[model samples]
Target: MTLLTVTGLTKSYAGADGELPVLAGIDLDIHEGEIVALLGKSGSGKSTLLRCLAGLIPPSSGTITYRGRPFKGANPGTTMVFQTFALLPWLTVQQNVEVGLETRGLPAAARREAALTAIDLIGLDGFESAYPKELSGGMRQRVGFARALVVEPDILLMDEPFSALDVLTAENLRGELLELWDSGTFPTKAIVVVTHNIEEAVLMADRVIVLGGRPYGSIRAAYDIPLTRPRDRDVPEFSKLIDTIYRTMTGRADTPHPPHGLRQPAKRTPANTPLPAASVDGLSGLAEILQRHDGHLDFAELTDELSLEVDDLLPLTDALELLGFAAVKGSQITLTDQGLAYSAADVQTSKQIFATAAIEVPLVHFITTSLRNSVDGSLRAGFFRDVLAHHYTSEQVTQQLDAATGWGRYAELYTYDTRHEEYHLDTVPS
Candidate 1:
């Protein structure tokens, strides 16, 4: 009972100077009543595949068949919910939901009935007449869902629809969607959700598809979600699964940045001048400085205090600085107050991003947030290491976290005493 089948799908677009392929030789089958998770990085053609399957974009050379027939462009049997809620502001909730039915040119009474049913199904029973402006982020997203469902599509295509909602609201909607899907009362024979969240994929998808490779996205791996429905996150198996998906998605078995005891050379700045504030350009020199110093060193000792080379820092320093989490001045390159704030925010933001990816289990994002908020010292390091340990060594976590926080001061305080092979967090004496 295959609801949709896409074969020989390929897509390419002209770039600034030449044609670039986004998807190549992708073949996928979505079965009846099954949820399929499509996982990939930002530009990895996950969305392109979804758009092609939904007929939003025509493939360069491919055929998309819906229920054993060639899918005509934007047919009623298929509906899509975009990451951005596509509700018409001028329209009331009821009107927005009804738009799906209007395309069918159904009679007025039939359209109204279908719209009301969708509204109820999505838990908007009392607010049928409210406008998009009158709803919360979650409710607005529900309107998008209701609209998609009203058409009674055989297959539903969702492109990270919950990515925008708050966590509580997203979780609620997820529950609702699952309830409806489990009840088997709606016409939805299958669903295809595209996400960057590995946990989201594992939780909802019966089968998880990882789009890997370069030039054109290829299937890196396809895993079956064997966990029982409504799985617990605290379980060991769950954590293991999360770790596995994360490694696959990032295209590495272990963590990308490992901590070496080597400290970067310090970036020199004025003794009293507050660092000009950290930017992505200076993060690498700052990192190398910290490594050279073996952790914490005063700004005056840095070799390149006045002028620092910036090109050597790629992805690492760039990501840290561009995100506004570190800074440098004449004698001292230190973490700006904002940098500290970002470290805290990054923990939660990363969690949210990971949660949206649709993986059943949560790993990196989960551990980062977990350690940031915990009160116990060893628990902080232990739990932190527990999650990060699989992909990175304790030293690596310490180094990356150190660079990220511009907490070279903290890094020096805590170093692994290999004699005991235990991490010791040193509290600086005021």
Candidate 2:
């Protein structure tokens, strides 16, 4: 039976320029006995789509249906496990689990029964009175899971539920979740998990759906994970599946090498291109790794070697590409001479190299130019923020401005007074 259906799921927000579209033309159906994993880059609206599904946020346009009824504000049959455990430190595990049930007006005895069952089911049977701060991160997230599961929803929404956990803890939690799902005893008819970890998606999901590329998120591709449960990652098929998904996210591999000294010129990005947030130090570290491997690293090979998801590694690579430190084509990431030089340079020289490349990014250039032309050689950061409001969401503009501020200071292009939230020219062009 179809448990959930979404169609033409267009979402947008008011911006200075016009409506800034988020999810566009989204169509998806989750059926009984299915676990659908949504995978994507950082800003691809994976979380937004989940919020829309939960009816926590109204979409600008589109429809969500749960069991043939139009979904609206906090669907009665749905619950969410947030990435952050979202547990109240003051509430004990049992209390936390019963919070939702109590709100639904379940009698105290019934709520206690449900919470006890959920805590036991999630393997936290003895921690009923332990508060969030008393439990470890993994233990706290177990309470998050129990809280969601205790409600006995028809569908459970998980937003990168395990991404915040340490590796071992995440793996343990994923195993337990799969066991409960596959056991056929869990109350939820279906589950939708949002994650950035490619392997985690493949590990726990029956169907993997990727949301990628453009910020106006749409389903890029969906793959049925052919392997059976309790899957082995070392198997050739598993590795191949990871490679296929990576290539799908990156849009194919196997490009010929660029010229000896220079990388391919960057494609023009949007004026509000949410500039890469990976740090200069991180990008240089990746560059040095690629340099040692002959200035090229295969996509799948790097993931296996570094044990990093594409989401975790892509930002570093993107920063490298943006700064002319590397060129990524398909599965191959090859460093340019500039990248090689940066890797080999001392701290001061590396800063100059980064600055030379960073000054060309539109946002950085805007800040530099704005400060240079200021009458008093200074301006409030809010000025650029106002300009960016035309291009990005308030949250996105904040992140962009923060990145630009860090990169600008590192490049010696300008100085940011955090106390005043102001920008000042390092050297006024008189």
C-alpha RMSD values across all candidates: 18.7, 5.8
Looking at model 1, which ten-residue stretch has the lowest summed lDDT? 268-277
Reference-based TM-score, model 1? 0.61
Per-residue lDDT of candidate 1, residues 1-430 (tens digit): 9878888777655432343455666778999868999987544679878888888888877788887899667644678998779889999999998886787788889989998988888889999999988899999999998899888888899998888888798898987898778887766888999987877888888899988524356566888888877767788877677666755664322211211321221331111011222332254345545544443333334434535212122233323333343443322334444444333444455334323321111222233334334453213345444544433334445544434233322223233334543343333223
Q: Which sections of candidate 1 miss by over 4 Å?
A: 252-430
Each candidate structure's count of clashing pairs: 40, 0
lDDT of each residue in 126-205, candidate 2, tens digit only = 99999888899899999999999998898999998988899999889889989988898887999999988788888888
> Candidate 2: RMSD over Cα atoms?
5.8
**Deviation from native of the Cα of residue 74 in model 1, angstroms:** 2.1
lDDT accuracy of residue 279 in candidate 1: 32
Distance (Å) between predicted and true CA of 139, model 2? 1.1
How many backbone clashes are present in model 1?
A: 40
Model 1 whole-model lDDT (C-alpha atoms)? 0.61
Q: After superposing candidate 2 on the true structure, give the runs of residues whose Cα lies further than 4 Å from its correct spot.
A: 252-272, 291-295, 304-309, 335-350, 366-402, 417-423, 428-430
